[model samples]
Target: MTLIKKEGPSQMDVVTATASVSDQDSTKDVSPATKDSHTSPADPTEAGLRLYDHGGMVLVPTPTSDPKDPLNLAVWHKCMIIFLVGSYSAFSVLGTSGLSAVYPSLIQAYPNESPARISDLLTYPTLFMGIGNLFSMPLCVTVGRRPVFLFSLLMLIVTGFWCAFSDSLGSHVAGRSFFSMAAGQSEALAPYIVEEVHFLHERSTKLSWFIGVQTVGTAAMFVATTYIVPSMGIKWWYLIITFVNVALLLLSYLFVVETKYERVEATDGAIVHLNFAEADDSRDSESGAVRNGLRLRPDIHGPRTWQHDLRLFHFKPVWSETFTFYKDTFKSLAIPSILWLLLLNGAFLGIYVYQASTFAQVLMSPPYLFKFAYLGWVQLVQILDCVLLVPVLGYGTDLLAKVMCRWRKGVFQPEYRLISMSIPGIAAVIGCVIYGQAAAHPTQWSWMGVVAPYHLGYFAFLGANLVSITYAIDSFPRKAGPVLLVICAGRGFISFGLSYSTVPLISKTGYDGAMNIFAIISGVLAGIAVPMYFLGTRFRLWAMQRLWPKLNQ
Candidate 1:
């Protein structure tokens, strides 16, 4: 009667009724929830228990009777995890992108510093964030993800205060840098959280949705700060951020569960994953144990008490493993596919930041000299850009993956998701070209024409960014921790390089030449997608069989 049916195009986000999502969406007529489910003989590879629903949707990870297991947690509990993951990461985008909204006020407040010096408030923290990526994952893995997240929130709150009260530019830069270092944890840890809680079918939508939430939240902050700084002053604006961080910390404490669960591996030492597009017709049956999209767990363990969740000490606090992670981080970098995904993901991040750094500068000067406060309203473009992109990136990728797997006779590969990158990749190139031309000659184009396409360029980079990450996690589900840290650290470094080069490059080559050069770089990197589509699965399978154990060892 409602969208609560799990079989169709997976519901994008929560709408109250719990929805079931499958990588391979069922197209046949299936009985209703209360109807009895009929299943075929059990799989015998390991003396199989029933795993398929009546419509042949393979329950990811095969639902367990253990209530404490993450997969078996109440639907409401999983939803809470989803909300917290998106919310904390969304909050981090403010320190990075939203800071630019206050630049006009900052220049007036510190009349002694040049505009370029004021931009350091944005630049220095970016560099520190890359440095923070080096440690973000190891701490999550070695100490426990929950503790690391909690600690990062505390630091964000503390640093926000330091930034608000700072009397000198040097002190403010130091404060912002530390704040970004903490913010890096949220970004670096997000992928791991996505992999931990979601089923295979649900991953694409959940990941893209969270990324969208952050991007939209960032713009909303821009809109807020622009208006706030003019009326209350920049100092008061930061105080507002500090209060928000405190509230986020309180919410995180209530909801975020530690997501460091042990995953199962197959006989050849590969991770066991189910691809719904490959469903065997022989198993087109179901189990009565599954009802209303939940695995009916026995009451043997009793109801899970809050203590299993609220306890602070989940691990032994292994400080020594931090060194182990540091070593593995570099070792993981040598692997070819891992490296490609890392660079691909980082390049898009670099592109996004470059646009963020330049957009305010260009819009505030010359043919269109916009007032500082007015720039906040311009964020509507960014907000609209993300809103338009969420469905295309999230649902589009999931649907593409489902169809491609069916086309391949049910053999689903990670490369199937990369197809989502094609349109966005080209859009990025075009957007860069148009933006450079607009920036170089302001008289020819109106503000609407320039900013719309310029902000719209985000469509490509964000799509590419999410695709590269989703594919990597799919390829190496077990290596989610180490691999994510590598990508985050790489992007952090890449962002620093792009931010440092931007002003000098613009000065030497003119805005047109500087941005066109980025267009070329972006286009060239994008070319790799074709080969990745054709060759990615082979490399992933080989690594799973041959390379995975060696890197882990």
Candidate 2:
């Protein structure tokens, strides 16, 4: 069952294989039109149906005639969902780094506290954030996305207020930790949400927006807190974020809907059954309307009512699925490709955190006694790296994939995405070296000289992040949630550990020694992309044949 392009007025078409008599007999209570749609085909033994149209670039995820399927939703609806999720991710990262900008004030507020102890404000929250994924991932899989999102936002609001009002160091630590645990859902689940709603072509660009907003939010908060902390005091940071959280929470309640659906693949001439009865009836009524068109099915499932979407509880969690989540996570770690991605994502993030954690301490002392406000300006390099690099790499990689697909006669390999990583991989190494050298002799070089490497290194890091995750999703679309959860958890924990030890590590080794050591680690990890580009396809095929079968069992 192949997907051949038909020269119709519309560019898109649905190609479903005809169902068997047994299927129709089983669903006898279904409507006649639906029954006819599911009736047996002439040849019933055909396998390996085409699921995507490379010539027309259409998804073949077997979206029901139902408008409720995320793949079949209206453009406006898709954009709204994307915007809300992106905002949620941005705010999550913002909260993670909110305290970093005001460390000076935190130190003064608790005069007896050591620098490392104060840094716990950032460290503990980040650690809990990673741990949160274990619970959030399973809950999302069982209950649904909407409830998890609403609950997470509520927790953030409550915790943000707690942090704002708290005076004691212990209270602050507890509040931040709980707040991070809630916010961790955004990191673990947002990419999965993007995958649920968007198609293969749309995934990379939208994910870029999602992750780009996260980085921007982190950098922007530093800039905003610099001013807010000095005049309004450190407590105001939480108050501001709390207010923003509340507004976003309301928006989420109104706009976001459950995106979970079981999509089946059908080939040309196959009879596909519609999931929703209302959608089937509506499609049946539109006899003259062409089914094979670029337009999606109109919303026959009816209006997006608040009552329907606001359901707090849905499915019960099975303990077996929870066990599978853990088992799959550990089992995946053994795969060479998955292991490489874990290292790639974790090392870059750990190195980035190391730089961020120590940046203020190193710059605020000796030859470069940068004021708090000026310290915020130093993060502009990272902001620039994300803003400029994310779009280029995201859309560029997609374009590269399309070009390669065309060249290879419409056979798209996941390894094609890795080709774009070569430039960034080399850049990361160079950036790390320059950043290390500049830190060693701050007076010898200007501030720009010191920061240039950091920017370059991060640019490469961001690109690698986009490519690696997209590749993973492409390789294992069904297990995207667990795959991404593991990456987020691994990186988050690595970054947390590095953040915790940054002060002491630098104290012992000096700025040059710490930076160069991390640089070497990052260089080796990023350099792995070269071999991955050439051999990644073979690795993916090997895993699918050997590793996937046992894991599935």
Say which candidate scores most in lDDT. 2
Clash list (residue pairs), candidate 1: 38-286, 39-286, 278-410
Cα-lDDT of candidate 2: 0.67
CA lDDT, candidate 2, residue 8:
21
TM per prediction: 0.83, 0.83
Instruction: Residues 110-205, candidate 2: write the lDDT tens digits.
Output: 898787677788788778888888788877877777788888999999999998899888898899999999989876687778767775655678
TM-score of 2: 0.83
lDDT of each: 0.66, 0.67
| Model 2 regions lying over 4 Å from their true place | 1-54, 60-62, 266-307, 310-316, 550-553
Q: What are the per-model numbers of colliding residue pairs?
A: 3, 10
Per-residue lDDT of model 1, residues 256-317, tens digit only: 77766553212112222221333322122243233224433446544445787776657787
Error of 2 at 246 (Å): 0.8
